[model samples]
Target: MDGLFLLSSYAVKDAILIRPFSLADIQSVMEIQSACYPANLLEEAEHLIAKHQQSPLSCWVATEHQKAIAYLLTHPWSGDTPPALNTPLPPKKPKSDIYFIHDLAVLPSARGLGLAKRLFDTAIDWAKQEKLQKIRLIAIAGAADFWIKQGLSPVNDKTLSHKLDDYGSDTHYLEAAI
Candidate 1:
C-alpha cells in the first residue's frame, strides 16, 4: 500500500506551483507577509514590486491553483546600511556581489511542504546567475537550527558590523558562500 486511497478525488500535487512573482501577485505577497511578520517588519507591496521590477529574477512566489501561497525576495547587500523598509537604498557599490534574502514567508496552511526550501533554492539559483559571492539572511527566533541545517553558519554580529538596534534580541545572522 505504497499509495493509499484518499476520500477526495483531487490530487494535492496538481494544486501547487512555484513561479516568478508578477505585478499582479503583489497583494497576495503582502497578505502573506503581513501574516508572517510583525507590523513594523512587514515590507510594503510597492516596495516589493519595485524590487521585482528592478530584478524580477530575484523574486519568486509559490502558488496553489493560481493563488499565491508563499514568496521570497533577495537583493544585493553591501556593508553600509541595512536595507530597511521605505528607507532610501544607498547607491550600489562595486565589489564581489553578495545577496541578502530580504523576505520569505509561507501561508500557515502551506507550511511543512518544503516551500521555504524551494524559495531558498530559487534565491541560490538567482545568486549563481548574478555571480554573487555570498548569500545571507537574518534568522528570527526559533529558526537558527533550521538555517544551520541549510548550511548557513551563524556569524558574529560584530564581524558583519550589523547594528543591534534594528533586530530583536533573538534574531541571529547567518551566511553561506554561494
Candidate 2:
C-alpha cells in the first residue's frame, strides 16, 4: 500500500497520483486550498509558495488526470508546539529530526477516494526514509479524531495547549512516533 495507490473504483482509471510539490504547481495548490478550507483557516498564497520554496522535498501534491486535486505540505520542525497556522515558515532549514505536517487537503469531489490517506502514507514513508523521530500536526476541522484513528495522539503538554488555541477553539496538537 505505497506509492500511487488506487483510489477506489470511483475515480477515472489511473487518474490519481501523488508527487512532491514543484514551483510550477503553486496556482493549482492555491485553488485546492481555497476549495478545501475556510478563509480564516487558509494560508496566504505567498506563504504557501514560500513554504514550498523553503521545503520542496517535504511538500507533496496529488493529481488526477495529471491535474492537481489535493496536496499535503510538510516541513522539518522541532519542539512539542505546532507552528501557528496561516503564517510564513522560517527561512532557515534545520537538520530536522521531526516532520511537521502543515496542511493536507482534498477537493470536495475527491472525498471518499482515500486521497488523504494516500498522502498520509506518503508522508509516513518519507519520514521513515529520512529517519525522522516523529510526525506532528495541528488537527483542525474536526480532523483530530481522524488523526487519532491513524495512531496520532493529542499532545497533553499544558504550555503547548495554550499555543494550540491560536489555531481556533477546537484545534488539537497531535503527534505520532516514527
- After superposing candidate 2, which stretches have Cα over 4 Å from the reference? 1-12
Best by lDDT: 2
TM-score of 1: 0.82
* Highest-scoring model, TM-score: 2
Tens digits of lDDT, candidate 1, 27-122: 999899877877766666677776676567788999987899999877787763356654544555666377888778898889999999988887
lDDT of each: 0.76, 0.83
Error of 2 at 3 (Å): 19
Lowest-sum lDDT 10-residue window in model 2: 2-11
Task: Report the CA-based lDDT of candidate 2 relative to the real structure.
Answer: 0.83
TM-score of 2: 0.88
TM-score of each: 0.82, 0.88
